[model samples]
Target: MSQVFIVTDSTADIPDELVAKYQIHVVPLRVVFDQETYLDGIELSPATFYEKLGKAKVLPTTSQPSPVEFMNVYSQILNDHPGSQIVSIHLSSGMSGTYQSALLGKSMLEDEQTAEITVIDSKSASYGYGLLALHAAQLAQAGKNAEEIEAAVLKLHEQRKLYFLVDTLEYLQKGGRIGKASAVLGTLLNIKPVLSIDNEGIIYAVEKIRGQKKAMERIIQMFEQDFAGQRINIAVGHTANPASAETFISLIETRFELGEVVYPNIGAVIGSHVGFGTIAIFVWPA
Candidate 1:
């Protein structure tokens, strides 16, 4: 039987132990603070990034990995596991150019090497598509081929629902990722914005509520409406906010039958855009 491997970017925000257990290959994106640069989850940890973010006068910037970087990781993977099939999943192309760079890297490979590789645009971000990559890796480990795994992932991508509540819209506004919700920014002073990625992978406001606690409940309500009576897997993601994440997990566990529960920390790159105290909940049928 042929072996299949999973590849994703640091923006996926998948937990380290799961990444290690699945042997998932993650290419790091660049996180820049003035002239200083650090790999997203590598040189800089999420806790450190949040600490710096709290004090920094200016917001940090992020950059996608180069095609050469992707090519190198892919080459290394194939080198170690000769003739293995690779499924490279990535952050939404609408949010970042990481997916396109992955495609270019695939193009740079030898025809034979390229043939065994599949590049996918997750059209989701944070642990939204992060869960997809994890599921794909699980399928790959179960002896599923790249085709079967990709199909399974894409199917879940369509069915999955993700919602995030930001402490403040300031980071998203400054980062220029506010998308459709940019209009209501100035007016939304104490109002928490509920955000989600649309089908095309763009961020948009799902709703705005008066309080943070209410907004979090609203997300669970939305999930209840969407996945009622279904067995599901849940991924709770947070940026320096575990209390809120645990609250979310507790609420979800009571509402649905869950298979797997994962706590994924929102890393530096995505954290830069969402800011601290942001909690994201991603759910799909098990």
Candidate 2:
């Protein structure tokens, strides 16, 4: 492996195969149900989490990894690589404390140890930043240094755009991430909400559509206006809704040229907040 190691949290929702192929290091978050807690994607799979969520009496809660947790992972990577660089990319700080925890984790290291770690707040979620981590690893494998890889990833982040089509408002409202979107709650059952993380990484509603089909179409339309026919790398993140995600990808292909495409299940930490049938589409110029 290259001397530069790319690290990201489970909230990235990167598929297991890609993580293994790229050897990306993932620091998992946690999902809690009553008295039980499980690592985001390690102890609990997205499929299993949704099943438990459906049968549970209370809504499950999610927690960020502690600073010690991050430190342990960092220390291990350094021990193994000896003088390697780590770029720990994480979930949006506006959405969770995970990003802050990572920063604190780096601070806990000695001055010499701290110089090798760079923690970045993705200011994006799921495969939005997951795509960046993947790209960073690809750059590392190409013999690019940490500084060059980080600069490329940051530029990619600025070019990226993502939208989440939530099937219901119940999860968002319950998870306390409703924010200004609370105004759209309690509407008719068919009113699907289109949500996106803003520049500051806060989840906000783009629009409330009358149906799922229309909502997805509006999402594509928004992307068209954003990219305007540039060749792009795209990803589709879903909470156990692959069929819908596939259909959405076909529609996207008709509009813009695609470079690489990734389809990953939205993990438990994020799934608990979006609930089932949530489809998120992320796009960045290739």
Instruction: Give lDDT per model, in order.
Output: 0.90, 0.89
Model 2 TM-score, 2 decimals: 0.96
So what's the TM-score on candidate 1? 0.97
The clash numbers for all candidates, in the given order, read: 0, 0
TM-score of each: 0.97, 0.96
Model 1, range 16-104, lDDT digits (tens) per residue? Answer: 99999998999999999977999999999999999998888889999999999999988888888897999999998988999999999
lDDT (Cα, 0-100) at 118 in candidate 1: 96
Q: Supply the global lDDT for candidate 1.
A: 0.90
lDDT of 2 by residue, 1-286 (tens): 3498998999999999989999999999999999899999999999899999899999999999999999998988988988899988999998899999999998888888889998989988888899999999898888888898889999988888999888787898999877768888744868887888888888888888988888889999998899895998889988876898899999889988999888889999999888888899998887
Least accurate 10 contiguous residues by lDDT in model 1: 181-190
Off by over 4 Å in 2: 187-189
